[model samples]
Target: MEYIQVLELFAGLGGLHIAVNNQKDANIQVVKSFEINVNAVKTYQENFGHDVVSNRNILSLSTEELFRQNVNAIFMSPPCQPFTRLGKKLDVNDDRCNAFHHVLKLLPRSPNIQYLLIENVYGFESSKMRDTMLEILQSCGFYTIEFLLSPTDFGVPNSRLRYYLLARKNKKFTFCKHDHTSIVKEFPYCTCRVKSLNDQASICSNCQREVNTNISSLVQQNAGNAAQNSLVNPGKLHSYLDKETDIEQYAVPDKILLRYGNILDLRTFQDSSSCCFTKGYTHLVEGSGSVLVCSRSVTIEEAYKVYNEFKDTDSEAALKSLRKLKIRYFTPKEVERIMCFPDNYTWPKDISDKTKYKLLGNSVNVHVVTLLVALLLHS
Candidate 1:
């Protein structure tokens, strides 16, 4: 049988691998993954039925060793911290950002590989590392197509925007240009604005009775809009409520809501696409910043909903089962969904929540990689 063989590097939670494996018509198979984080390795092993070589950094792995595996394609999502706007943006000099260099070095020694796919933050295009990687790929007889895309464009609820590069050996691929004017029309859900606690309290008087005055004042001060204070009394005490009620009735106050609005506002220029979800999401979920304070972090079930929205109906039952499994952070199954892994794949059972988060955060979204793979297959 003619099959597509893939070698995945930085394979956090096996998202790319899972997605490729799920494609009914695509003959893609992940032969191995190179990852250094033990937590991520555990999660990757759980879903893919492959043991990730943990604690062994990609830089230490030899090209000859990797070549022995008979890889037809190379898939990677290098560390974006060095190029992320949230980080120092150090580019090639960042010690943690060494994978790209190793990938370039290995390419020359592995000319048999027919395709290369890379995913990263948008800032990569402007970085020296990006230029160098592009140069190496071009020199190695790969035609490249680069684009900035978001899950929202394909109906995923989150605005996770990322940069994707698809290259094929000795073949040309056309780069798709994004039309800024068409975004709002194409993705109406991306325009969802932050809603304030006061606005929510007005609709749910039950919630207004629970909020304390001090917290309300702080929320007002931080969110920057206090005109809706009359909607609720300051001396009320907050009470624990069900998940749906909490989101609908007890959302952060107007003051904090303003900050979330600002965060969402900052994203307007980039169209409806969301900023990348990273290991940083844990911090964002736990923090008191405007983004965290005003808007709730997307839950695992919610993430499933987003993924399902973009997917075909045939996977609905599988998505529901995965969503109902209900573990904090994404479970190996949920992580598989994000990676686009098939329903029958098995995950490692003994992974930690921290590991799951780290691996999923580090993974490439499966749909994104599938598109790149499809381009290569056609090329």
Candidate 2:
């Protein structure tokens, strides 16, 4: 089998890189990665045993320099802060937002590059940046397919909804026909079905009833455990009180209350999925942080428990047990698992926990990426 050469831009901690590595048919090799954070680059290098260019502003790399490696595909997930609705929505004017422009300018120089994949927040679809990106691809004679997908759709418990763009230079590439149907069929594990706002409202009464029934059962099973072990109220403790408490006392907060309170409520369980796991956990100061006021954030072990329970059986017993564990948040390895990264893959052991969290938070869920890549390669 012929292998595909990949150059990953804004590689972060190599989430895309790991997913590409998992491709069975393609000889996926990440020739280079451009990252601005030194710690992130360090972690990337440590995990992949590749030379990651650190602190190198992506705009500074010329088109010739990027194409010098003769890459066949380029995969990127740019910093999403500019496009996220939760943020400033700075769009094209944001310094980070301009990175996509740089990528577009570089693409024309690489004729051998047959494929391009970009991942970002769902808000990217509406942003001016997305329009410009589509226009650039069309001008370059590439066809594109865009979708908003979540990790839960891929059988992962977390509801990480992101925008994914797959572009191909070949005229034969049809976004509608290129195995997206089979991709969805094969990955029924994914909770992120492509549905329009109209279709969501059009669900028949029977479908809605079934959905409600399932949700109610899930809530009753997980809510109690989540309340007893996972939830916490941060507002109750003054900042001064946090400092005064010993590390041990602060590590574990009061059992999370299910009812709404001034904390990270366990009510998140009642909803369909968990919040996007971000590097926010690193900023948490057991007692003082604003993110979550629990004994510890959910750990990798716990995350795995949730994933296994949700994916394998959707069993209430498993979820209840997972809620009771009192570990600090999941390790990077565990996060990798939740993201469907293969167990044998290597990660940088030397990097700080903060960097790992940032990398995982920024990465594309491997299962989804793998499905995309397979479709491109086979189609």
Candidate 3:
């Protein structure tokens, strides 16, 4: 069988690379990846062990190199800042948006590329970038389908809603006959997300009811099934916790526990699930995401007593001794598990915890893209 050769753009730490490799398809090979982040490149190399990751700016990516690789599939998750609501909607004006334009310029020169998959923040669907990308793909002879999807929709605990586009050239090796305009595929009904207790027998992460259909069971059951299983199985928040962890490090800071405690997305070990973990996760708790409550053996009285003493002192130094019986940020490794990366996935030992979190935040949910890759193969 001829191998499916792929090129990854904005390949942050090889999320797409991992997806292509993980996909249960026939003989898939990622020929090249273009990324500018040094740390991300190192991590990608560690995970994928491929020298094909180029440190060169994608804006300067050579079409000849892509052609040389004889690439048939293109997988990209471009920077989303220019189209995000939190950032200035600079669109084409933003220098960050230039990389996407560069990709458009490369497409015409690489007509052999049969499959194109692109992902971005949800806001991208309504932005100028969406219109421009659609136009370019259509002019280049491809039919496209778009959607808004979340990892939860596929059964992972975390909810990371993203916009995606899947495009293909028609069988005649010319323009797809399925109209030049974009076809927005209605997202499938997500039965996998944890919901209110009344909605189903399955335990709701938010409501903590006994479930005949357990979230953890759903994950395990789907894990071994073929690509058709669609593991979007609903699971508990604690479904992601590593079997063991260093509680001392991830424990909530005394300062944060004291002031913004109530607003924090704190969940006990058995809670149904967590919020979306953004790049601002540890830095900001409000809407930035969830923290798992530790199951330490300390008494509630002692924990509160320690908290009060730490609060009374009102100093960073006092916080050093403030050991609560509960709560910690989901470790970077745990986050990786939640995102469906393999157990063996590792990074450089020198990489900081902050960079680890940032890389995961910047990366795609591999399982989601894996399903998309399967679709690209079968479609």
Best by TM-score: 3
Error of 2 at 185 (Å): 13
Q: Worst 10-residue stretch by lDDT in candidate 2? A: 226-235
In the range 1-379, model 2's lDDT, one tens digit per residue, is 7667888899876777766765544677778888888777776776777564455888887767766777878999988989875679898999887777888877777677778888888788888988888888878888677777775554345557788877788645442444532222222111122222233443324223112222222222322111111111111112112223233422323233111112342312123334566655435422211222233455535644554546446545544444454323344554555555555656556676567666677777776676566545554
Clashes of each: 15, 13, 8
TM-score of each: 0.61, 0.66, 0.79
lDDT (CA) for every model shown?
Answer: 0.53, 0.57, 0.71
Error of 3 at 274 (Å): 1.6
Using TM-score as the yardstick, the better of models 2 and 3 is 3
Arranged by lDDT, best first: 3, 2, 1
On lDDT, the candidate that comes out on top is 3
Put down candidate 3 lDDT per residue, 1-379, tens digits, no spaces: 7577899889987878877775543588898888899999998888777687888798777788778888988899999889876789888889998988888878877888878889998788888888888888878888677777886665566778899888887733121234425544433222233343246544445334333222323233333212112334456656567888888788888778777654777666665457777777788778777887675575444655655566557545334333444678999988887777777889899999888888788888877776566555553
Alpha-carbon runs more than 4 Å astray in model 2: 1-3, 52-55, 174-272, 282-328, 344-350
* Candidate 3 TM-score, C-alpha based: 0.79
Q: Model 1 lDDT vs. the true structure?
A: 0.53
